[model samples]
Target: MNRYLLAGAAAAALALGAGAANAQAKFDVKVGGDAYFEAGYVDQDVDSGLRSTEFRNRMRINIIPSAKADNGLEYGARMRLRANSGASNTRTTDADRAYIFAQGTFGQVRMGVSNSFNDETYVTASMDYLKLGAYDDVTAWINLPSSTAGTVTGNSILNPSIAPDANSTKIVYFSPRMAGLQLGASYTPRNDSSNTDISRSKPTGTLAGTSNGIYQDMVEVGANYNNTFGGVTVKASAGYMWGRAVDDVVGSNYKDLNAWQLGANVGYAGFTLGGSYIDYGKSGQNERTGVFTETTRNWTVGAQYTTGPIVVGANYKNGKDAGSLGTTGDRELQVYEIGVGYTVAPGLTLQAQYDYFDLDNDASAADDKGNVVLVRSILAF
Candidate 1:
């Protein structure tokens, strides 16, 4: 049944585009992309056999084909291909976004692999010094314990929202903005299925005290506000996500997903102040005896000043989650960050950042503190 629904949606979208095409105006194809190269140095308490320096780079291309109908409705499709995965110089490419969209006075509708409404429009702290859309680059530079991976919430402890949907096939709707407010919603059949894959098997939980994060029938609703009152600009976002957990085994007691996000920003006189809170209250943890469960959450606050071609910013982040399934409690992560960026030319930038981080682990031996410095060059067109 779910597969048929997806097929029908694809057919309908193609038909709409075909029937609405204007012979006088052909489809317009455009190409654009961005690239970055970075080098980093790290000093930490646990650096045994770990290299203090590393270099990394990535590139991506966005292919867009769009057209407008005679009645002012616009239709389009976009695919983003990236070369971001490499091990020992072996590189591979993959598409992270592929979607069909149509927009009119009613706003926009997207079908296929795309972000949720909240992921697309949520307002957060202004991070001008960070590269592109990155918020948790520190994770890539530091070694957090492997046991810190799962909480059934955000992709990582530093991520600010619940987006376990993982770019799976979905349908999203965005209402037209009115009086500085906009509303949106999205539905995903399964969090693990994407692209051309069709999954029909029902997910089942492990026995007793084990936990799993996979979910089905994910739904999200969100709203955002954007307005400028006199010399001050105000922006805010709120969102909620919920889903059904895997079917439990005879002795297992698994919890469903329930996560929410709130963020706000205010900017004036070239300075911006903002903060965000994300909460996942034991959303995907097992509740049986002998299993440790805790609230999964993170919050961030920051301020930045932009003057001419230079930008300076700083922020503090705190994240906590349930550690190992055994007797340990929550693990905490804290980071104090400061950074700067300078535009060398139109589409070119040079950036430098320094981060001081402390990790309080459930296991005493895994706890560590570190300082890192990174230099980067970015080009976009």
Candidate 2:
């Protein structure tokens, strides 16, 4: 959509509905998204016989609906729609978050599926939003490095207390910010077929844990803290989740997953520097947990400098998979990228980036290395 036309249409809608109910009064509606196109060309030893050109693209739209009142009771929801060329044939409604929340001195409590509590801290050190660009649970453990493997066990349908899904069909609570301290929790019930009536036993894998024949749902709790000392900001976050997994499916025993992360950022003049560390937990049962008991760690250290309308940045990430069930081997991957961006207008920008990655000891097959070039046009208001 044309940026100007989209803005104009939203403004007109607000003008037409200016006198609606006070509680339902419309505020400014912002519309914008971005598209990224990338192409890669690689060369290898002639005898190696490996050559190819890969094209990949993605488009994402982020929408936010917000409202305010004279008394300061605020409410809103955040939405995201994404399209990818790699997964061209797949389509699903991936709701990021939806909640009716209020903000005040006491804090904010949201009633709906939203970001988990443990996922909130490390705002300053987290470059996933701008640096490494990968923000899943594995990456969430950058600093603290817990003992649990970063995998979810069991289905809530089979065992209500152990469901692994994080985003939708759940209720979450977030406490207001107090001296940079934030707390949150979320719960989901077992409302599926596997939970109500199960006839078969689940598989007893090498690392399945106590997930033998359970049939209850689950909950997660987290705490985050951010503080500034001298000139640097420090962040720490942790969370614990326990649930049941049936036999062939997920059993009745309790399986635990824990995650902890720490991050720090320093700014001086036009330069910013930051990094993060994460650790996954181990399974409790000897037979059902060792496959995932190996500790995996991921981290990124990045720096960026912005001046006027231009910004240049680069990042390095190290990913490791240690501790496997079999005698196969360990897996490791390293990624590096450098990019530059320029703002052409208030809501439009252009960016160019180059990325390189290498994977060794891949459990699937041969080793691999590649380079990628990307060009993007972004519109955000």
Candidate 3:
């Protein structure tokens, strides 16, 4: 009898393992990622002379699991593991983005750390090269002095030419595409919120009469349209964002921040052209008097041509009052880049880019101009 009992237990264990394996087979799961390696030489002529050659590498892995229920509802989750060799000391190689979504006839609802609707729907004329074209350019080669703060370094033009609050923890909804049009909306409880869950308790222990953070309770709405007429394809998008003040630092003088953007792209016969304009509204606050200070604006225009395995692109961007905290007269950046990309294999591409940047400030006599040349290898699978 004891021997028979042992045999029964072994059969049960095998049955349970088979059941679990069959259940897992019902869902589709995929693993993929990309790796990017870049080497560059930078030449600078800012307030002083600087030259450097650098090499950097970044890798990310994406795990995507999805299932389609019998009722026609599809659900999935995406998680990314990211690591970079050239990141700052504070940067961590961890799960940088994780999100889950459900979709069917009612469109898609995504929750967790993801890009806002404005950042998702807004169009740009820049090319999607290895470095994202105008988005990165060559601003890293130049360092401009801060106008308001004492000798603080400033960023390049690309950082300001786009909307703030890129990827944050939020809930987003996207409507189904209808007649070449789609709508999206997102709400974020806090601008600085990262991969953490929303906090129930209000943060404390800040300086008296000052706000806890720059922005809170943000809302973004956007629309995008894409269609092909004749032999040309056209895409356009517009977005608006608003955020409530975290505190009444400036009392009644404080107003909710607002921003908007417009962009369009046209493609024809292996050539694509596009442009975008963004307004970041009023984000600056006077530390001494706690008053709203300055507004920011950015614009870019670019074009690309693709033939077989080679792609070439060029773009120019301008930013005004890029340093939101600085006086209006002390913040302006202009940048331009030209690049070429060649596909070497099914999942590999090589690219070379040349970038130039200029920083101008009426309040400062320092010259901030620089250039960078970069070559990159990208592998995606």
Candidate 4:
């Protein structure tokens, strides 16, 4: 069946379910979202001598509905829609996320487009109070030179990590917590699903020469534990992802790409500390030889302190061969950041941050340092 049609069918089914819930008066609905704005000044020591001040803003709304069955089973659905300003005075609206889930003592089952086990479970120390803005430090850094073949660009700042495909249809299962431990798993038939249009067709034919379509039959599993010891609370998680090669011209050349991550956090008094490490193994293949030739790894450490309505935090992140794809030369990045967030009122927060990026072996023959200062305001309801 056409995937688009299937998406429509799923939507219809969900609507019908919601209607039935309304008729039975067993439904609960809530609407909430956030409005965010940021202004920042950037300074790059590169040859171009780029120095600029920018302003950006975005808004989103989330609709959530849930119901509980007489047999102690609960079902829920979430849909998020967003509008943001773009370059050249362009604005766009999109359904960022839509998913349905059911849960009970047996555990929980989630279907539709959502985060994978790896993404949902991994722990990190970055202060993401305002994820809509410069949440991570990598954006300030520059990429270095490399020698390996088949270089791919536009890698995520959080490299060596596994994330769900963009709007790819998938199923995820999360086991109920037991003794502070919980497990999760997910499966995706194809990774080329569209986020903006659910009716997009899946890619087919040979993947050898295709610029897109890389993984098939992807599977991910993760586990996390949360517990407190004495005056300190701890949270830790680990995850792994593996997928089968798609449309490989040579079996060996097109090998399965795998990634894993380990993270932990501890909180004591008003202070919290944590770190995470990620490794993406041979995920890139040489475009010429079609052979897997590159790997990426990175780590992050951070600390935060909170008192009253104010929180202050600092973090350091380092990446080796970050986003190098299959290149051979040294590609490295380091980010140091400090920030403070204050609660001005109910559902409103203001934050100020400073970030420094240190780049080495950068592909661009320019200065290796850059800095940014930003102020952000967020209102949620």
Query: Candidate 1: which stretches are off by over 4 Å?
Result: 1-25, 86-89
lDDT of 4 by residue, 318-346 (tens): 87542333323545677788889999898
**The CA-based lDDT of model 3 is what?**
0.66
Q: Is candidate 2 or candidate 3 better by lDDT?
A: 3
C-alpha RMSD of each candidate structure in angstroms: 2.8, 10.9, 10.8, 5.3
TM-scores of all predicted structures: 0.93, 0.64, 0.82, 0.82
Ten contiguous residues minimizing lDDT sum, candidate 1: 1-10
Candidate 3 lDDT tens digits, 1-381: 332343343344334333323233366899999888889887766534454787777788999898776555667888888884335655567776788776666677777777666666678885866453337546544555644421101223455223455545777777789999998777766655667656644322223332123456667778999999998999999988777654444333333557778999999999999998887654433334532245567788999999999999998888765243333343777888888999999889999988888877655565467787889999889
- Clashing pairs for model 3 are none
Each prediction's number of clashing residue pairs: 0, 46, 0, 7
> In what order do the candidates fall by TM-score, top score first?
1, 3, 4, 2
Give the candidate number with the greatest TM-score: 1
lDDT leader: 1
Instruction: Give the least accurate 10-residue stretch of model 4, judged by summed lDDT.
Output: 144-153
Question: lDDT per model, in order?
Answer: 0.84, 0.48, 0.66, 0.66
lDDT (10s digit) by residue, model 2, range 1-381? 232342343344333333332575576555566665544454322215343455555666767777765555555665656674235657544434455554544355554555444444333232322322432212211111222222443211001112244444444556666897787665544312221244343334333442222223445666777777676555555555544443333432233344345555666566778766654333222334324334445666778787888888887776664323342454565667677878889766777766566656434444556565556556554
Per-residue lDDT of 10-111 in model 1, one digit per residue for the tens?
455446545655767678999999999999999999889899999999999999999888867788899999995657766888898899888877678888
